[model samples]
Target chain A: MVVKVYGPDYGSTKGVLLCLIEKEVEFETVHVDGFKGEHKQPEYLKMQPFGLFPVVQDGDYVLYESRAILRYFAEKYKNQGTDLLGKTVEDRGLVEQWLDVEAHNFTPPIYSLVKIYFASVLEGVPADPKAIKENEEKIEKYLDIYEKRLSQTKYLAGDFFSLADLNHLPFTSYLMNEMEKGFMVRERKHVSAWWDDISSRPSWKKVLQDYKNPYDVLKEMNLVN
Target chain B: MVVKVYGPDYGSTKGVLLCLIEKEVEFETVHVDGFKGEHKQPEYLKMQPFGLFPVVQDGDYVLYESRAILRYFAEKYKNQGTDLLGKTVEDRGLVEQWLDVEAHNFTPPIYSLVKIYFASVLEGVPADPKAIKENEEKIEKYLDIYEKRLSQTKYLAGDFFSLADLNHLPFTSYLMNEMEKGFMVRERKHVSAWWDDISSRPSWKKVLQDYKNPYDVLKEMNLVN
Candidate 1:
């Protein structure tokens, strides 16, 4: 049975979509429109108690948390399309370590920035300049660490592109393209190259081509003009 | 050779210590005093660029990120001591899912509370009541979800006690015992029980008996009254 993924077509859902495509796993998306509060509906909440995006149902097994879903498909189909988890135990350890780094360090600041920049646009409230500046500083400090690490290794985990690097896609895309913070990536030489390399991957390209971002969906629904 | 863990004996370092003990892996501590800015030194930055607590060195392989270290040792010693990563792919997926939840949803607010509550105690500054209240509400909301999940299963991932459950030890202990927020755990029946159950594990008991918290070290160093 093809896996059924329930969520909007953007954000973390796109991360999961990119992973599935890379792993050559067959899956279909069941959109739960967050703008409409459909994710908070009891039916959707059954799969994801927190009513978060991108819950995957593979046969009798169900899972949420996009990173975990990415790991699941990567591990389940290790040899098929992409070698995501890496080959050895040590490599896998580094991958897991950097994955946590992305979760704890990288995503938070970028997520805050996204909320400050984009959510303000949506909610019609003025963004707090102080909070935005603080978040940018945090991101710069973190990316400096990444810049150093990426100088040594081609990717965050190692030379191979693992889930650690892949995990940064959704929010970093917001940082780079949508939020007008591309300099955060472009200012650092190795990081800029790394972003270009990973973002241009065929899998990510295919995801971009197929799925509409959340804002686009809102425009289509006449929720935002 | 016994693994060498570099960091102080508290906070995230203790999480790795708990995992090592549970897995029956022999290890020694090399304290990097954060209060003294030792973690930010050039040599320590070589291992962990971000200068975070608890970087583990198992022979030549050095790894940081407390959760990742837990997963690493858990995988390496899977057949020896406690089985943490679960038995099958689906089980492992669930374990990874809850681990992410603990990292993303659970830890952030609790961490913020820790900094707000405990850091104030250390810095001799007045704790911000508004920020504390906000963090408390965030933690309470996340715990409500955990309460529902724990009501169904003995642990976060499943009936088996896995890393997902174990990862809650460090901060939750601070919240429960030290930070005077025991009511957060005590308020939720299932979550309170879950906390009691996980906290009573012999491995955690040993960690508490063996290690000193940062404040204790500060007092010993004549840095704090």
Candidate 2:
């Protein structure tokens, strides 16, 4: 099946691309630059009302939200490739549970850590030390929980490497590489091992090779004013 | 089948209760007061390591996160009552897409608005107008999208009321009733109509009639400090 993905090259976009690759899906891309207001235009809004991306259109059926799109692809092509969800109902529950953890728990703190500390520098604003300190404590607490979970099981859902683990790649990669917080992952042995396992997956490697870093583009444009 | 849910009488907790009621599933609850740190105890952490709740234990299996618990109960009891997910692959995808919207898009801004204003008052701090103004704008934009979508379909996922629609109940009710922002929902005609239709469901009405508000308990106990 042919799929059309609309988004700029960003962290959220990589998650969908990685899902597509894992499923061995063929797809074309239509880049919609947020800075250019392309994503906010009426046409893009028709497909993705939230004005975020990447949105996937397989013929007339369209879906958005990176994790939701990943899930749609995984469920649609469950038999064609590696099963990323799980094999049983309980496993499915665990997978959904951890995915919710990633969305509701893991993401917000790390994102604030990034925005308050690093992205603010990109925008030529002084970093808020108090904000950074508070967010660091929050992120540390979240990762401590991750460490315990990873120590108990090989992956977030369980022994299997599921979407629960895969969903963390994009943001964690940004934290380790761009934000230079490798210690955040590395200090926790189980989390580090878990990261090493998932990040080394062929699909994730493909995501690394194919997807461009938005931060690098922002740097090149020298848009910090 | 008997299910036991562990959580306080908060918004997230009600989402699971509503789901169970909708599915015609029998469940009992053990209230875990967040103000008392009961949720963070070793016993509660064993069932839900994240220390947040609406965790449901059915026989031997346990699940957490209100939405995940809802999905588990819905799937396990799909044949017993109303189907809360969807019938086909496309429908399931749609349901998931909107569920993510509620999780990632709709919930965050509303929660932030609550924390910034009312919850801050609980901490003896004046509400920051700047943060409130920003978050209110964000909430407005998100609700506009919801309005447009509800105008097109009878519910978030489609004409049928699914978990996606049900998930909005707890937070929307809090915003409308507790926060006195009923105007936010009432202002958009289609959204207002959709709310009227879904909130009128016997299941949701029961949730309102039975579940106690955490804020009320906190007020009674003078625990806000």
Candidate 3:
């Protein structure tokens, strides 16, 4: 059975779709437009109790949590060109390690920035400059680790392009856009180089082109440029 | 090779130890007393760049994240006892689901309480009543979901005792003591009942007995009594 993903365009769900594309796996995308509160609606919430976007249904199997979904897809579709999860026990552990870093260290600051600068506009809350500054500092501290690691390795998971790099594609994309407007990635040369490589991938390009702006309602609120 | 875990008697490391016990895995615990800043030492930092406790070294394999450690141990020691990760694809997905819920939903409020009520005393910061109350309300909202789920299933993974249930043990123990003082868990019937069952487990009992002082430290902070 084909996998069905419920997600918004240009969101974290885009990461999952990009993975599927890179794996060349056929799947169906069910766009749950966030502007309509579709994700929070009864149907979507029934599928994902937390009402988060990027819920995947593969046959009778249902899974959320983008990292887990990526891991699941990678393992299930191992015939795909890349063994992104890991080829060995140590590699798997390292992949898991980087994924944790992505979840615990990277995403928080990225989301913090998004919440203060972007989400406020999307959710109609006033943006807080103090929060944004705090978040920027936090992002810089976290990026230091990535910068150090990427300098030694070609990808997040050493020399190979693994799910760890793929998993971080969306956040890097968002971060790059933020950096162009004076965010800190450029100063972190290794991170900047890594981001440039992943952002330039064909799969990521497709994701960028295909993602629908579910938060367009925020435009009505003068949130997006 | 005997698995070696570098962890303190208290904190989230207790959950790791509990998982080891539940799996009937033979492991040696290297207690890094947090009071001395052992976790931040260069050697420990090499094992866990985050400077967090609960770093496991099984032979040449080393892993740091507590949840990831639990998954690794569960997968490696699958025949010892419980199938905590899950027996099937869907089961594993649900295991990941609850784990994420615990991490994303449950942990924030718990951490907030720890920061305001517990960590403040340890760090010599003044306790903020406003933050404590805010965190308490957040925990209450998230516990309602756990209440509903536990009312239906004997365990978090439905009918089987899984790592999901084991994962919550330490946090719940801390919360229960907190509830006894000012933090509230008694009002939620199902959550209270679920707590009673899991806390009564032998593995949890062993963890509580082993981490006596930190438990006292939590009580001294009035986070638990």
Give the candidate number with the greatest DockQ. 1
Clashes per candidate (backbone, < 3 Å): 0, 0, 1
Candidate 1 chain A: worst-modelled 10 consecutive residues by lDDT: A114-123
Q: What digit string (tens of lDDT, one per residue) describes model 1 on residues A1-225?
A: 999988988888998998998889899999888878999999988889888888999999999999899999999898999899999889999999999898888888888877675576667779999999999999999999989898999998899999998888988988888678999899999999999999999999888889988667657766566
lDDT of 3 by residue, B1-225 (tens): 888989887667888898989888888889887767998899888888778778999888788888878877887777786668777656776777788778777877776776565456566688888888888777777777677787888777677778888888777766777434324567777777777788898888887776654757557557654
Colliding pairs, model 1: none
Residue range B187-214, candidate 2, lDDT tens digits? 9999999999988999888888887886
Tell me the tens digit of each residue's lDDT in model 3 across A1-225. Answer: 888988877667888898889888888888787767888888887787678878998877788887778877787777775678667656776777787778888878777776566555555688787887787787787788788889899987678888778878777666666434335778889988888888888888888776754344466556665
- The TM-score of predicted model 3 comes to 0.89
What is the CA-based DockQ of model 2? Answer: 0.72
lDDT against the true structure, each candidate: 0.89, 0.84, 0.76
Q: Judged by DockQ cut-offs, is candidate 1 incorrect, acceptable, medium or high?
A: high
Chain A of candidate 2 gets a TM-score of 0.93
User: Which one wins by lDDT: 1 or 3?
Assistant: 1
Q: In candidate 1, what are the lDDT values of residues B141-193, reduced to their tens digit? A: 88989989989999999999999998899889988876778998998999999
Question: For candidate 2, what's the RMSD?
Answer: 2.4
Which regions of candidate 2 fall more than 4 Å away from where they truly are?
A: A222-225, B116-121, B222-225
Please report, as a residue range, the 10-residue window in candidate 2 chain A with the lowest summed lDDT. A114-123
| Stretches > 4 Å off in candidate 3 | A119-126, A178-183, A213-223, B123-126, B181-193, B218-225
